[model samples]
Target chain A: MSTLSERILGAPHGNYVDRKVDRAYVCDGTGMLTLETWKRMGAARLSDASRLHVFFDHIVPANNSTTATLQHELREFACNSSLTLSDIGGGICHQVMSEGIVLPGEVVVGADSHSCTSGAFGAFSTGVGATDMAAIWLTGETWFRVPDSIAIHLSGSLRGGAEAKDLALSYVNRLWMDGGTYCALEFIGEGVKTLQMDERLTLCNMAVETGAKTGMFYADDITVQYLAAKGQTVRPQVPETCTYIRNLELDLGDIVPVVAVPHRVDTIKPVQDLAGLPLDQVFVGTCTNGRYSDLVRFAKIVKGRKVAVRTIIVPASRQVLSEAVRTGILADLVDAGCTIGTPGCGPCLGAHMGVLGEGEVCLSTANRNFRNRMGVGGEIYLSSVATAAASSLTGEITEPEVA
Target chain B: MMQGIGHAVCLGQDIDTDLVIAGRYLRTKDHSQWVAHVFEDLDTSIAPRLKGAVIVAGKNFGCGSSREQAAIALREAGVVAVIAPTFARIFFRNAINIGLPAIECNITCTEGQKIRFNLADGWVEAEGKQYPIRPLSPRMQEILAAGGLVNYWKARS
Candidate 1:
């Protein structure tokens, strides 16, 4: 038997980046669709039995008619397919499926770009176009291109002021815009040595922003230990060796506070550069920097302060929600009059959940602020949670003043 | 890598794969049904009048996902080539990897700037400069000559 990597790279018949390669469909059982936008296709494709997950999540708080329609379709599809993960209302799509569904070494695809989040479980996860996803939904298979690989090694101690959000933004800046195209970004290093599981998840969540197919920080003892506590799957262990085409190195010690300005991710500069720039709003959420530490960081910054007239905080998961509540961070936030939101993706997707209206400028920790991405007549500047939090309080672009 | 002033239009940055062909219309069986709809959101007249069109854009012109459909839809819709101050990391590679002529140069084109791009001749004429962009690496030239990956592989067989 050929090794899995060999099968992945050698079989052009089954590998494609959209140029009609041959048929090579196999199931490792790491995916499913909860919405019927995919149901317009057949159900047997999901009967790959092991490959299907068909979950209904992240479409909640149905803020508008279109989201409501998609959610209704998802309920119908999940019911028709008899899938367990379907209709699991209260979690992010990535969190819901992997809670107990996705297994290791599985090659999975989803329509959502963040589908790569499954790599945390050691699966070969990537996102697909809705049409390709539809075809896979009918035939139970799709193809792929053997992408090049880039290794990002994070080594050193994260000083008191730095966090994963800072690290991710720093990494993106170093690579600039076209640094990691059609490549697999493999994150490795020593500073990663002490980061807990959710923090590591926060790092890999935005890997797609670099134009990489997926970002995978290898699962080590930390991975297994966290899973064991959750009672999730414990797969055999091995060191992840890299066949990276190139390597970029980083030390958390020197990563300065930064923000990606309007229009482009690579146009990043130190947050201090834009001092006194008026800020109309500040947002702290999205799959990227919306974890517990993110909230804790925001709370710490806003403890004795009040949000400038227009600032919002969006927690990404119910898990982060409960933990923030348990630690009393949510109360500190509300006491400061920061408009805290439910555990759904809001400001990030421009789903209108927390959009800033026309002529408004928001400093945010969310990713991808494309035209109208957050709402009409609004401009979004991408930044770390610390920057967003500090800006919310000062009512202008600022840094976390917390010592 | 196109030739002559087929005409140039300026589009703002963050021009995603969806702006080329929206995700919702992807389910259609006939590509013409949807490919023709490419960029309808940006400019309705673009598709019908693109038989000999060229585009010049600011940096990160196609900086989004590795969706080749974006290139395919553009090619099928008659966009000869693109010259950008810079391009998205993935979109740049995807274009070249799939044998589409996408060039990156440190230049800008104003609206209605007369331009002649010769991918075959290996240079461009824009804003009164005939600067050179290295032509397709030999392997890439072959892929583009073959008119896409499937045909290239078919010829190899």
Candidate 2:
């Protein structure tokens, strides 16, 4: 009996194993460094150019000439090397990869920490540093110290305005930062089936916040349906009994909307505890909660109501953006006085597009709230799209009404 | 045994990678900018003091982001080593991959106190006390001694 990570890596807990990478990617911020390291290593011939991807999402449209030149160089490298490139506005790298590229039971590695987001699809995915990625580009393989697994058993279904983001916050609060370090969080139980693909992605996206190697759900019909919709088919993975370092059980029905307070993702509290707190801005997008379902939930909350504060809406990808446009969700958000930015990681990493100013506060749906992450001296509060939309309507941290 | 001595610089717990190098400076590959701006968020004065320094920090040091630039910045800034009770896994790997020693040990020392360490012996001496560290694997020690994974790989190839 083996956990998903052990099954994929063919190694037991705490053992080092080198496996061939099925997919490897890097964003612009890391891509330049990776390219430099590759050159430093004699520009060795790539092992598998087709499996490599370069995404420009962190700082899109060039924040300045230096960025523009670097992006231009990356574009040239991608083209010359025959690697896949997702240009500016293509959406976040993880979101784009999840659209159909990443399959179940494959080894996926990205330079960005959010790469673990793909583990939602049942792949053994994790993030590595840029130089490590450069080595992957050269050798097509990397080593991992197979982490022990922690089985998280979830039951019941979320209700009453609670969302996957809230559940994610709840789990992180329980685990605390670094509690799951060097461990794989295997989410399994009746509640796993209750979550749709978007929610599953949300859960896995925040795994890194716990300092975990990855968060994963075993592939089932929900996973099958999600891939099937994209014209791909996959078999459901049978659950096998495996030893876990720790076992945790969560009842989703008991969950309520919560927010991760400033400076730490694990500093969580129910939304009502911080209600009525004024906000300088509200952002609804990121790999964490920037999908079609998330936008729909956000639009449902703020529809036909004027926002009381500056709100930014960034779709996860071009596909998500066009779906919002085709379905009138974009119009509803725009009519509510929300500013639409390019479909990328907008102001999530304090890179560009609506970065918070000194002494400013923002309620965002993105993951991390680490100090100075969005901007120096600026505060970030993380929550669900529902909580973000509810807050935007009143210009304060507000909990959403039961849907 | 590869080892060195340097003045100690102390910091508290959970020092994240963003504080090591902000996203605003990531667009440029100029290593000097990274060295200059390292720890600017915490204190601009820390950068000037980093040269030949052994940073002794609390637990979970380098906790967020997988940016290798953080490790690069510290190495280029002439940091002799970083000693913490624990490290975020990715940062620990990045540090070793870049030839920056990330020692796992618990030690208390005042700022500017001279510190001595032995990587092979897995112990650090500060303020007339010796604290044993979790020894690195032979593979990791080889990479660090080779000045990083690139050089290690080059020698192998």
**lDDT of each model, Cα atoms only?**
0.62, 0.91
Residues A1-403 of candidate 1 have per-residue lDDT tens digits of 2222223344422134332212211111112221222343333345343455554334346555654555555555555655434443345656554444555556667656666666665555666644455445455554466666677877887765566777777887777655765566767667777777666666666677776667765567777777776677566335445466789999888877777776566677777888767888888876677777788988988887888857787776677788888989999999999887766565565544566778888888876655545665577788878778778877888866646
Candidate 2 per-residue lDDT, tens place, A1-403, comes to 8999999999888888889999999998899999998877775779999999999888888888999999999999999999999998899999999999999999999998889999999999999998788889989998898999988899999999999999999999999888788899999998898999999999999998888999999999999999999989899998899999999899999999999998989999899999999999999999998899999988988889999999999999999999999999999999999999898999999988998899999999999887888888899999998999999999999999886
**Which lDDT value does model 2 have at B27?**
79
For every model shown, what is its TM-score relative to the native structure?
Answer: 0.73, 0.98
lDDT of 2: 0.91
Clash list (residue pairs), candidate 2:
none
Predicted structure 2, TM vs. truth: 0.98
Cα RMSDs of all predictions?
Answer: 7.0, 1.2
Model 1, C-alpha of A139: deviation from truth (Å) = 3.3
TM-score of chain A of each: 0.85, 0.99
Task: Report DockQ per prediction, comma-separated.
Answer: 0.15, 0.74
Clashes of 1: 16
Worst 10 residues of 1 chain B by lDDT: B22-31
